[model samples]
Target: MSDAVRKIIHIDMDAFYASVEQRDDPSLRGRPVVVAWRGARSVVCAASYEARKFGVRSAMPAVRAERLCPDAVFVPPDFVRYKAVSRQVREIFLRHTDLVEPLSLDEAYLDATAPKIESPSATATAQAIRAQIREETRLTASAGVAPNKFIAKIASDWNKPDGLFVVKPAQVEAFLTPLPVGKIPGVGKVMQGKLQALGIATVGDLRAHPLEELQARFGSFGAALYRRARGIDERPVQPDQPVQQISAEDTFERDLPLGEFDDAIRRLAEKTWLSTRKTERVGRTVVLKLKTAQFRILTRSHTPETPPASLQEFTEIALALRERVDLPPSTRYRLVGVGLGNFRERDEVVEQAGVFGE
Candidate 1:
């Protein structure tokens, strides 16, 4: 594709999981709702705007959300119901464009440059989609329209909760200039602090630094930052993107010391390995993820010269990865995840493995 203009829209549902709970139960309406299982190890899947007022947020520990909002109703996630609703919303998108890239159950990116429906502009297409979603699902959605994916994603959140924001091609630089570097995707708290330490606070400040200097400081990610600072993103919106990895994770009923997690790791590794069998792609890397009782996350990954050949090999590899955890033995963990990643086509794996006569 050339440097031709593109029409992109990012649609995000308003408090999706919590909103679904409120919509389904009359008692939950107008009340603070936290969507999560009730347990010491449970985490919030979503929080209603009402609950958000009390500082409750998604991914926060359920116990903490309770402390934040004493009266909030806690509901476990019903993925079946959420999937049903998500399908309806996706059907609506299909009517407008086949270039629909779903980000999750409640969000997607639509390329409306050549839409199925005749719209005067991308902004109009976004309004139509949002309206149809509200009419069919009785749920509100926010949208952002821009010349590219990253800008569209950011614009969609500018005026959130049933709002729409637009960033025209001519205005992308101006739109980004005064925005905080943290507002750029992938620039999280740690990255933002590092950038600010260098007196790079806003997007303009990031643009001021030479690319060589940025790469020296932050490596390849710095190159990404350089492009984003200039409001340039060339990634195409890909629909039906392939599965990148397969994994299973669980939170412990009680926090357990590192040595006590071997059984958990074996079970999760078996589960993950079985999932990978369903795909033709082979996974070469085994990842072990641990979440401390205090909520810090740590992961250890190893890519062997060849993919694990059987369930036994996969399990042993996952078990051995546990030794890489340098946390104090007394440091209990609340969660464990086993994953197979770095997936490659079977033919490619075989071709690479042939080089070592394996």
Candidate 2:
């Protein structure tokens, strides 16, 4: 890393899945929309800004989200469609910079230190990207421009849903000072509580602590925190991140017996299946994970000589694995997850099988 500052732009789509639905279906516009499978065991995938005002949020249980906003329209997730739109956005990103790191289908970080498209500044580059996203996709995006990845990510959300913000290199220290410690990446509620116990509520308060003390308190994470408090992140944006594993899990509102897990298993299998389709690689294993009411965790997996050819085969394999569980029939489960792992590129998997397959 050089002392010279880098220009990074973080672009985050606004309520991506829900907004896509609204864009394609005019009636969904201006109406609160929750994108998710409609079931007690289902979770919200994305909520439109209109839905957010009513307290609906992504990953929240669908049952609870319904209670929060009874009038919200619930639509099942369509990852295939979302992934198509995502590819369009990715094309738009590559037009400006090759150094684009896609964090997900809806958000990415672009290293515009030297953009392919000549721009007056990184701020202009971010603005141009946002505008292009709107013009091309008919969806909105928020952008943050800064010297580093962490700051850029945080700034992106400062003014969200079709907004743009910039933090100059000289302004980094002051920009982080008054910010809440929780605003720093990875500082979740548990970490915030730990920091508050030490009277560290803001970045300024955290900065007052000595590095040795912080390291002693938090180990490697604490040392990272010390640097974050000083706005000294040096991490680079990573592009073309390979697929390792894809899974979806849910914690039931109430524990269920193993016999009653069929529906949940099927739903989670579909989610993992849809997610895997977005990647070029093939997942070769089926994994069934269970957490007992007593908090005991168990996992079962099988890697077929060939990857499960269809969702039906994958879901059936997951259900069959449940029969392998040796727990007492009386035992109840609090959580269940379905996954596809042992990811290998399509060509690699095909070559190993001695059969040409997609």
Candidate 3:
């Protein structure tokens, strides 16, 4: 609404895991590589550009990736090392501005409207940060600089691998109009299909729809879509944001019988609990996801007034979710996932201590 422009930059590391593997091992240089174990259960964590030529992609099964590229090299993932490298890259970002939000280990958003320099231009900050990442971490990062997060995130991917793109404030609408609605964040497969069914094919088409009509059809998310279509996102870049969710999942080599599903759920719950050590916040909901042998997915979730305080409590909540699923006994499962959600601010909880004490 305010015509003021905010400089935002998005940076994504190039084939992060695979590149790190190659950077550490000269023997793997310039080769088609998939960072994952060779098994039906394992998914590709990252694929080198060479592997992408063969259609290998992250989250794709390693077996399928191998089928796509017979000579593709499979490497086990080392998330510990990846996280360490990510910290180093983040330190590089901190040197530029404090308004840094990490999307994942290899990607982040930076607000450079007020940089610690004589000139606080977004493009200059992006270039300097990228140069620093390459010089310090030996990794190349593609960067997109724009007036807002919506444009910056898309611009970052415009140039793949080691590239830099910028979308000036004046160019926002022209840049967004021709792009498909599917390109907007949160518009996934089902949402895109819905938009297509309504003759809203492009961002321009979405812009043409009455905001009230969109709200009538899709609720609050439709309002977000309207903003994205207009290249208007007002979310500020956040620094050191607290964790919102914790989850753990496992893909089975073969469809496991319902008899063994309980064990898998227990393991995942334990893993999820272990992963929560980094977060001070507690979750008020538990969710269980199951993917059948046919890949038909089902999710069951529950939210309690109080969060689970221990691993045993969390496991029990997960078991309750398992009881809610009424799949056929003969139906086998390919994956099982456990998650906790609906986090509350730790500080808010701390502040409520006196009230609860009363």
lDDT of each: 0.88, 0.89, 0.84
Q: Please give, for residues 1-358, the per-residue lDDT of candidate 2 as tens digits.
A: 5523699999999999999999999999999999987876667789999999989988677889999999999998787799899999999999999999887788899999989999999999998998899999899999999999889999999998799999999998899999999998778776788999999999999999999999999999999999999888787878888777899887887899999979889889877876776676789999999999998999999998899998789999999999899999999999999999999988888798886443
lDDT of 3 by residue, 1-358 (tens): 2324688999999999999999999999999989875654455678999999999998676779999999988887776788789889989998888889987788899988888765547888898988999999898999999988878999999998899999998888999999988899878666788899999889999999988999999999989888888888888888888677888778777788667878678767766764553344667789998899898999999986466877788889998887787988888998889999877776776566657667
Q: Which ten residues in a row have the lowest lDDT in candidate 2?
A: 271-280
User: lDDT score, residue 195, model 2?
Assistant: 96
Better of 2 and 3 by lDDT: 2
Candidate 1 shows a clash count of: 0
**Cα-based lDDT at residue 72, candidate 1:** 95
TM-score of 2: 0.79
- Which candidate tops lDDT? 2
User: What's the residue-level lDDT of 296 in candidate 1?
Assistant: 100
lDDT at position 76, candidate 1? 75
Q: Could you tell which candidate, 1 or 2, scores higher by lDDT?
A: 2
Candidate 2 at residue 42, lDDT? 66
Provide the TM-score for each candidate, comma-separated. 0.75, 0.79, 0.76
lDDT value, residue 125 of candidate 1: 96
Q: How big is the RMSD of model 2? A: 4.8
lDDT of 1: 0.88
Report the C-alpha lDDT of model 1 over 1-358, residue by residue, as the tens digit.
Answer: 5324999999999999899999999899999999887876456778999999999987677889999899999987776788789889999999999998887778899999989999999999999999999999999999999999999999999998899999999999899999999888878666777888999999999999999999998899989999999988988989877568789787887899998878678767766764565455689999999999998999999998899997789889888998898988799999999999998988988999898985
